[model samples]
Target: MSRAIRSAPSAAAPTFAALALAAGAVVAVLLGVYGSVHQPTGRTLTTLGFSSLISMKVWLAVVAGMLALAQAATAAWMYGLVGGSKSAPRFVGPLHRATGALAVLVTLPVAFSCLWSLGFQSYDTRVVVHSVVGCLLYGALVTKVLVLHGRPTPGWLLPAAGGAVLTALVLVVMTSAVWYLGTQGVPTSTGY
Candidate 1:
């Protein structure tokens, strides 16, 4: 029905944005940590900035970061829907949708790159955990309508907003942890 279609986009935006934000936060932080974590020599991170992009760690992080930014746009759109504002219509809506779609487009390359570079190892718990978390976040956004039990909130884009912001926060902390550990010259445990 037209009713269902009308509400779908609005609700979906928040969920997508939240997932992106969370993933982005994680990626950004992890990139930072990659440099901080030191080996016995503590010089392994000197080349982090440029090298990161080419590395498995950095690739995923970048994907997350890019997606996160896109998600922000999406959430903003959702917020407009909930808040009954047309502020997000100008460029936010299209930009959000494009970015979300683009994120998915990039997923294939990232996934392939990860599989090729990291091999079956990156398929370990730590990587899988992150993947599952990211997927859950995405799923939550995409399926929010079904879960809402009939479009409950008008200005309740909070769940989406909160999730996104939290994701960014978590990314900062997690990446910081990784960086701190690396800075300490701990061994790079890929299986984490």
Candidate 2:
């Protein structure tokens, strides 16, 4: 009888996943370290039509958070985790990507303002939590991107990375924008 041959299992997927995770962890650590070491300028770029940098940042963050929610819904639809359809429509993927991109775009200025003006602060519980989560946000984003684009990875990896990103986003928004809006209320006049 002729011998039957079997293919060896490939380790590429696990290896890539590990590398991606390590890269993300490194980025997160570096950001925290840099923020901790760097001196904050106490000044940030101003946006026209906004009362203050803080107001602008808060509003931008809110917008980003909303976009992230949309991204989540679209992602769920694509995975058949939401809606009643067995298969996602062709538009779902594009919509998910667009919303994700928009969310990142909206948060860029806010992140820059926070990192440049405040650095990493730990004077209070809320501030510390916000700072920590802010660093985690970028890390999670990196990991999610890698997992999404990398070679065939375990089915669970993408969702885990996405969940991490979403969690970080929510925490960052709740700690910063929500807190600010609750305590300061909406800015009504310029220079507020």
| Cα deviation of 34, candidate 2, in Å | 1.1
* lDDT for each residue of candidate 2 in 1-192, tens digit (9 for 90 to 100): 000011222479788888889888988888899888889988757664577887788888899889889978887787677878757788887888898988888888888788878899999999999999999999989988887776666677777888898889989999988998899888555442
lDDT of each candidate versus the true structure = 0.44, 0.81
At residue 102, candidate 1 shows an lDDT of 66
Number of the top candidate by lDDT?
2
Please report how far candidate 1 places residue 73 from its true position, in Å.
Answer: 3.6
Please state the error at residue 97 of candidate 2 in Å.
0.1
Top candidate by TM-score: 2
TM-scores of all models? 0.40, 0.90
What is the alpha-carbon lDDT for the whole of candidate 1? 0.44
Report the alpha-carbon TM-score of model 2 versus the true structure: 0.90
Candidate 1 error regions (>4 Å): 1-5, 8-60, 81-87, 115-128, 134-192
lDDT of 1 at 185: 40
